[model samples]
Target: MRPQYPFRVRHADVWRIALPACIAFITEPLAGLVDMTVIGRLGDASLLGGVVLGALVFNIILSLAYFLRIGTAGLTAQAIGARDPADGLLHAVRALLVGGLIGIGMIVLAVPLLMLSGWLLAPGDGVREALADYFYIRVWGAPFSLINFALLGWFYGRAEATTGMILQFIIHGINIAGSIVLVQGLGLGVEGAALGTVLGQIGASIIGLMLMLGHYGGLGQIVDRVRLGELFQRVALKRMFGLSRDLMIRSIALQATYAYFAAQGSRMGDIELAANAILLNLLFIIGFFMDGIAQAAEQLSGKALGANWQPAFEEAYRLSMIWGLIIAIVMGFGWYFFGPYIISLMTTRAPVQAYAVQFLGLAALCSLTFMPAFVFDGILVGTTQNVVMRNGMIASLVVFVGVAWLAQPLYGNTGLWLALHAWFIARGIIYWWALRRIRSRMFAQ
Candidate 1:
């Protein structure tokens, strides 16, 4: 007889966690899609390009602080797995404090950040002016956005995917409605789009906090349970800081790869940049869809590790990969068939639409490669193996830079897309290798 696997995870169990998270994740890019669609319909490629560049700048900056979400999720999942609700709450509180401080710092430094990004992107006068208008308005939402990130992370870590989904819907739904009104109805253009996003973020932050308080049996109980002295003890602080530091490094590397991609496209011209932005939105949709499965892996694997159940971890890993692969294949086929139609719907500009269609095939292929990389990210984050994660991202980024340098001069934009695919493949391979080396060490304990 064939040897049996250690355990089997039910399809229902995986989907129970994944479906809601997937819905939540898709809403994020859905909001972006709305923004792009509104700006694209304005009959000015420069406006679209400006929004794209401005969004990129915000992503690079805000994503650097994503450790607040990631670190909290990993730590809280493990705590919950251990049946330590108080400890989980402690992790959430600490993460919120850090996120709040970081958000404030971002606001304080917004001017320099905008100036530096403007200098680096160096768009044409029209695009530059639009970019400034968008950035100046949207930067104020940094704190609330970070707070909401922590809230979503905390909810997911607790295996409350439905609640997370509701929160995400609230945020993005308001964003979509507001964008439609401000950009299309009021004709405020890019600045209105930025304001709509900021308003959504701020509103979500408030509602999320209220829900969190209700879940924890009010503010008094939460405060009583979270002993500041113990929570911020030297040892606890070290562990939290260490995890955040490593994740911050990993995030910086990942963001740098995309930032480089966008900067290069900007240099190629406004049409090329706008085309790439459309394609990149498609990539984001794929990434977020895959991230839903990754989120499942994170919770299940972290719980297994905390409970000292090796078989559970193995089962979680197996099922996550299976589902991730299936979804990625479906997405790839869908993109291959319907991508041009989707591009046409976003913009009336024929050149931009045509250029995006030319690259749609490459984007579809990249989606297939994203599966392992994204799932492995969830597993590592769940395990709080930040050092390994950081190292792997750094290695993949080096490969991306090297590949882009060698290929871009020869093949132009196609070469850049090729480099992006290489980056995804490289990340998957490196993380797989690292996981293999660490598996026995992690489980044997």
Candidate 2:
């Protein structure tokens, strides 16, 4: 049987995936917002600073491991396009096993990881105690959190965005509720916030397992049908691992750029660091919307490739880019109008609020320059063009470093924002050129 929906990409088809994905994407940052808002209200910049530091470390770690989600999505989406359920299921399962093992490793090495992060980040003295408390408790959730990544990737590849959205809602909704109750109601501080997020991850992973079972009819049938020997097939594992390795390297480079941004901000002052963190979350909020459209590109492009339908592939790329640009424009204006109010709401500290307000424009402008990279990334991932993705990101990181080095010394934090935009622009251009060159070779045969 063929895949459902028209082969040609349509506006309605793109939104069918993008809308729900967009909603799902924002929920994550909203959860982060909830954490920031809860910690920020305490009137202690140090506590908020500590949470920021702890969160930054987790961000880098998760980013490094993000290949579990991305590689699985590309492989499963290809399997889906080929109408190979067995292969698709195998990809997801493999990713889950890998994610679980990585999570366990992270837990075992939690203390060392924390020590390394503290040394590299060199956070202010005021934030160290709270950061330690938050980091220690949060490491317990690593397994659940990583497993959830595989589950979400499975759904995305299947074009079951609604299911993915519902799962995200469950996880982030629980996070929001738990953080409020634990931190605000119980006054457990940064520890409460960390624990709240952990609870949400655990709850989602259990529910996701049930949903997986239901998808395949039942546990008994799946156990009988799935062979252990085939599950560890070398060819498939090598492909998955190779893709994951490149993606992992790509992710580290990307995260390192952002980490540098945070580290540099921290050096200026606690208030500057806190302000940048608030502003950074808003940037993430803008990014989530664009990323939602990117999800459309991932599924549609992969499906088209699997079917060997160039027309469908072209349509997917064109429509995805159009929608991404539209959303970027809207978000840019929206941020310009409402960013200050949102920043004020996130933090009551006068200095932090003022600083964030002053820099909001630079962040808003990011929507325009950064939108292309997000959309391009989806297509690259969907097509399983891992080498191109890896090379593009590394090149972009070089651009980021060069720009920052030249600009930061002269213009301060504003220069850092400019460097970030330069990176985004470089990525978009590199991907655009690479894809154009690849398309001829990919379909010419």
Candidate 3:
């Protein structure tokens, strides 16, 4: 007779993880909100436009390297599931090293990247100058930012959501305080905003490193267990590289879609671009909240897969989806009712507020679709199924482009948003189909 095992997922466990993660994830966009709010108070649409464009450029660039966070979380969770502390340590170390290297590369290539981005964006002179100032100062934070990504990923993968939350709080708290001081108190303008961001990143990286060392019982112990040679073992390195490469491709496609959205908005004029930025901030809030649930799914599902516990994986998937949908519905209602207030808080510009309010309803409708798309992302990443994720993102990107082509000519900015809505829906549908196939194959064993 076969042995029996208990595999149950409780709502309490999900909430325990999701709540802290929600707090942590939300801090990210809050930082952006703070930046926008401070700059918007400057009462210059060009300044807001410049900051928005510059931030979007960095967002796209950094998102390409997001595999450091995502791949580390998935790998570390699996290692923990297999009860291998050494493997978990090695994954974190490897991710940090790679992230550090990539961050440096970004710094080295910053000049050409800025030039290219400027050429493509082709903003008015006022906006371009502001973008240049912001980008130049902000690029210095790349190494620290990437390092924090690895640290946060490792913590989240270990189900140490509280630590992740604390780290994010530290980063954002310092950022918000510094931005207010530099931009408002000191009159440093866009450059001040960028410098404040750099300071926060540098502080977070240092503190996060100290915390990591302490978590592993100091540097001596970590050094002893994380053998340099072991980190480069042929099989493990192959798997790591494979996962990172695939995820990078997937991230680039995803970022490209957003970059396209921002670019299209820019073409509509500064007021429109600024308005889109404010509305998108609301979307970011929604995404981060739903991502809290996805984070739970990643950890739980990865651990389940590592242990070869199919039932546990199923339960994790089901409960995560349930909670995610619930939160999504609640957020949809909140945004519908409170979106104008939220937009007002981000910017005092009358035109920007009016334009953002026009599309707030569409943005709310899109929130309902984020849960399935994002939760499935967590599930697939946890299982290390990067190939399917990559394919689905690419396929969805194609659909978005096609739909935007047709819709934009007919409906303007509303058409662009409609394309975005379709993209989210398509991603969810594609991932769901992929999930079914993966379930059949994995469970059939």
For this target, which candidate reaches the highest TM-score against the unseen true structure?
Answer: 2
Selected candidate, larger lDDT, 1 vs 3: 3
TM-score of each: 0.89, 0.90, 0.89
| Local distance difference test, each candidate | 0.87, 0.88, 0.88
> Total clashing residue pairs per candidate?
0, 0, 0
Model 3: per-residue Cα lDDT over 1-445, one tens digit each? 2222345678987887899999888888778879988999999988999999988898888888898898999988877776774648998999899889988898899889999999988999999889989998999999999999999889988889998999899888999999999999999989989998999989989998998898888999988887768878999999989998999999989878988898899999999899887778678878988989999999998877766678888899999999988999999999989998988987899999999999989889888876799999999988889999999999999999999999998999999999999999999999999888777565454
Q: Which ten residues in a row have the lowest lDDT in candidate 1?
A: 1-10
- The TM-score between candidate 3 and the true structure equals 0.89
**Model 1 clashing-pair count:** 0
Ranking of all candidate structures by their TM-score, best first: 2, 3, 1
Clashing pairs in 2: none
Residue pairs whose backbone atoms clash in candidate 1: none
- Candidate 3 residues lying further than 4 Å off, grouped into runs, are 1-7, 39-50, 123-129, 263-278, 340-360, 408-415, 443-445
How do the residues 188-242 of candidate 2 rate in per-residue lDDT, one tens digit apiece?
9999999999999999999998999998988887788778888899987888889
Q: Candidate 1 has what TM-score?
A: 0.89
Q: Which residue pairs in candidate 3 have backbone atoms (N, alpha carbon, C) closer than 3 angstroms, thus clashing?
A: none
Candidate 1 local lDDT, 42-149, one digit each (tens): 999989988989987888888888888888888888887777857488888888888888888888998898889989878999998889899888988888889988
